[model samples]
Target chain A: MTTIQLPPLPRVAPALTCDPAAISACGADLLAASAQVDDLGTFVAGRARVDDWTGEAATAYHQAIAPTGRRADAMSLALRGVAHRVEEHSAEMQRLLDRRTALEDRQQHLAQQVAHLRAEVATTTEEGAAELQADCDRVAGQVQAYETDLDTWVSDLATEESEMSQAFTRVLGADDVDRIYGGVADPADGPLRDKPGAGASPAEVHAWWAALTAAQRRAVIAAAPGAIGNLDGIPASARHAANTVALGRDLADYAHTEDAGVLTDDERTCYDNALAADEARREIEGRHDPVTGEPIVAQIYIYDPAAFDGDGAVAISAGDLDTADNVAVVVPGFGTDGESAPYQADRAATLYESTRVLDPSATNASLFWIGYDAPDNAPWDEGYDGAGVVTESMAAAGGERLADTIDGLRASREDDPAHLTAIGHSYGSTTTGHGAHDHGLGVDDVVFVGSPGVGGDTDHASDTGVDPDHVWAGSNSRDPIADLGNHGWVHGETVFGAGLGDDPAEDDFGAHRFQAESTTRGGAYSFGDHSKYFDHDTESLANISHIVNGDYDAVQEAEHLHDPFLGPVEDPEYDREPTSPTTSSLTP
Target chain B: MEVVPVSVGEASRAWDEQHLDLDAAATQIADADTSGFTTHVRGAATRFLAQWQRHAEGLGTVSEQRADGLRTTIADYVTSDEATRGDLVALLTYTQEVR
Candidate 1:
């Protein structure tokens, strides 16, 4: 009979000598350097477009500078590739080190057990000795198992190091740089050759993006930032980078042309739009994170300075959309455009803070999505033109774009979906209503605040493609715009008959109406209350934050508008105490 | 020779300004920090930085040369214009005397 032999136990687990912090720091340094190089490249490209300088000397200057700009771009790409690999390597090393520490602790415990078992065997008598010996053998087998695990762990560490080295070698190769970024002077000729068609769904765009290499992504961003900056399926970080680059380039080019006195009226409008976008981004970036005191992240998710006939389109998010646990998109109504987006971003930031204050552990993101062309003028303005007239056609068109954006958000986060809420204010509520009723805006909840209407065809919450129970509305009693639907009554008789649609705050509309009243201003018919729903220290903002955090029970319910002829009429709640004591007395 | 519709002073100033910009750019590139990378990555980055610095210096040198050439050309054009004006004035005076 043959006995199976067990290998001797390892005395100790292998040590991990690499410092993950140092590795991570190095990665960060590489990224910083890469950004600097990219800036230099942009500067060179702008300088090369010296249209005012003419003749043979000008041609020679352009020819000399163009190649240098291209080289800068290639160098930037190479550094970024290396930085990405280094960061990934650092993360993997950290994970491996953690595993190694746990393994070492286990081995130490087993080694102590072996010593105890051997001591017991030495001190026991004949029968006890046999039992002790068996215990020793069992411990020995465990040690052998531990040895095998350590061996595998050590091998894995070596393999990881080898793979990292190989990756660095490939990223740093001169030929590799040329092959990736050299040929793509114009993005259309290189990385963007296989770009998905405009009609492609967000999922298809996401798939196409995921298939590209790091080098390819860098090339695309360097070559054609404007093309992909507003593309729906791209990640928020990438979009932010691309948009920032595009904005910088445009500002430089336009400023140069303006200096030369050759800027067209259209170019001036676009330049103003770009400036507004930059201002919004700067304002959001200046805000601090509620929990960490770090600067809050702001992403320019939509930036088309020339869209909507120079009224332009822009959307800014106040947090990291990709990783947030809850995301709230606040859509604005009439009189909002690129110029007013900075103010809208402030509301988004306020909502983000309110959500964080309510649930400190939950990660939240909020966006001021002015992605659609709202009526450019307020209806109440003097000599109001019919161009800003409330019409169903504009709402219908806006709804299509809104639906596409929401769908894109869902598709981009399929692996880990956030609890998304869409809040529409004033005429924007009509757009959101049509988006839900016509295109099925798939969201966890839909909110209409101070709404003029929901939709021309939507009569009930159920028709908005969301569960009737999940539909919510906030209409201050003093808000005049909130009464522009079937809910408005005159002398106990319905005066406004579903012109835009049934008011979302109407009892028959089947939506939960939340208390929304002006806290600072008191009056029965203050038109100013129409725009105060998002003000801090107000019930409206608090209740909206609760819904966004998915704390449905915490939402304070208000009586919906009902006819006085039927029974005792219910007046809207007013002058309620603010939900949080730490609320700031800031206007929206 | 082709007649160039060039503003000589403006063109010369522009070349001089470009030369300054190219020199500043080259200096910035040279001053970029390439340390803190992993051993192999550091080596690669050092090599790339060196190569780029050389290229930038080359561009800066060329820009300086262009500026110098433009300055000399501008001086020559000014001198030749003055000489031609003096000769024209002298011939006009001679014709008036003959009349």
Candidate 2:
């Protein structure tokens, strides 16, 4: 087995300030200084202007001199007000620096501890190796624990800064603070903030949003875009509008920051994702309809950077989810990101197109969910991540994310409920399977293609939460990567590193198999790759589109494999024959 | 003010990553060839691999019930990408028609 090289974990954020006195003093000083300035900066100007003049000539001189002096005085006051703000910002920066120093000191202490432990281990006898290993593991876990805590501290600091900006805005215009929060009456202690739309139930969210005035709604969209951008139970149009503004503004900011080389690694990733969001936007802008190459209206439901380790979470809909009768969520497999978003978008577009073809009046939207870390990433390998496609840990985690995403989608729907079908391809199938198996994934139907496994102990389609008949599986006969999941064949009882779950196509998995043309090299057991499941002139894509649109009858059944003993089996599709395969590409 | 479970899901991932993180850092324990520190680790891994192998064999019932399904799956395996075959060597040995 080959070993992978890994970099040591490094701390990413400064420690939180424990000096409440200093922080409180800074806040008090900023508030007092800001209050010291009159709202219009007119006091100095009034004091500087002359009251009267004696002669006509003197009057003209006084008139011009008085206005000029008044203007200059106002300008001076404004400059001073700005200078006071600068002072407060500078003070905040110093506090941050102080916190950083503390964090660095702590880190130094840990580093010394690690070095000491290493020295002790170096002289240990063979009998103590196990003890040393345990010690090292404990120390490393501690280091990781520190990094995690630091991230939380960083998150808190960011929140503090946002609140501070709100506070600053209040000082600028207390009367207009309502507008600044996008109609949130009082951002910190207001109806919207008291019960944020994020985690509220659908009815509650809708009710809260409905109670707001139109101007208030617009204000919320402006000031707290993320609040409405990702909140459940909001209209898709509203979310799209909010996200569009946010995307454009953030991308512009990121572009400048990235070009200046001032972005951290996570910030750089966010920058790339912003670009990807723009690319998908362009795709929607370019398309006229789901199938036709023309312009169409759409929504960018969510674009979050704070969560999921900056891999970020995004959902793009080609049609309005609230108005549509059908919604298809396409969960992609390994190596999915903004760079590959356009391709996934294209696939989504095609699914939308297929749904249209299947039914003349079927209103549909297709969404691409690349929200989770799919697997150990590589370029779009025919098999997932090339030689690194050895672990299902990522898929397992992605399953939970997928489950939550589906729940969010359901909660976000407006008007009448839409029939939602989740579709997954390759390792994505495994991710979805686990979602269904573990997370009570709420969906109407599920379809799988080029799946490995979902997770352990999921023996039937019903076990995945969806009805057995509603669970669909499609795999190309010549495809070689499908079996790596080890779902199709027998295995030793003690097999470790199993796929996410049982194969949905397996007879006992109780999934409906649909026909798909082989997208592999013409071979019995040789060199076919994954990724061709969506190729045109194939039955798989046709079946997947049909499933999404609820055109179940239109989905073609797989070819009879002619089981020599059992005649022919139906439901999940299967390959025609087996031949010897070379173990060339799948070594550690 | 509120501390939700941020580490709830991440804790497991961190443990899983130790193979790369801790193993690489403590090459003294991971690289068994010249390192006494790795002896315990190598033995533990072997035990795990062997134990899971037994768990994998419980599929004897599945193989019989879905022989034809397994046949087509095996066919796909033969024709599919060769990159993942070695990973399934144990299954292949267990499921081949002769066996």
TM-score of 1: 0.62
Best by TM-score: 1
Tens digit of lDDT per residue, candidate 2, span A108-185? 767776776767665777776667777667777777877776676576567545543443333233223223322222
lDDT of 1: 0.71
List residue ranges in candidate 1 displaced over 4 A: A1-191, A378-386, A488-499, A564-570, A574-588, B1-99
* Native-referenced TM-scores of chain A, all candidate models: 0.69, 0.61
Error of 2 at A86 (Å): 33
True contacts kept of each: 0.00, 0.00
Clashes of each: 0, 38
Clashes (candidate 1): 0
Q: Model 1 chain A: which ten-residue window has the lowest total lDDT?
A: A489-498
Go through the candidates in order and give each one's C-alpha lDDT: 0.71, 0.55
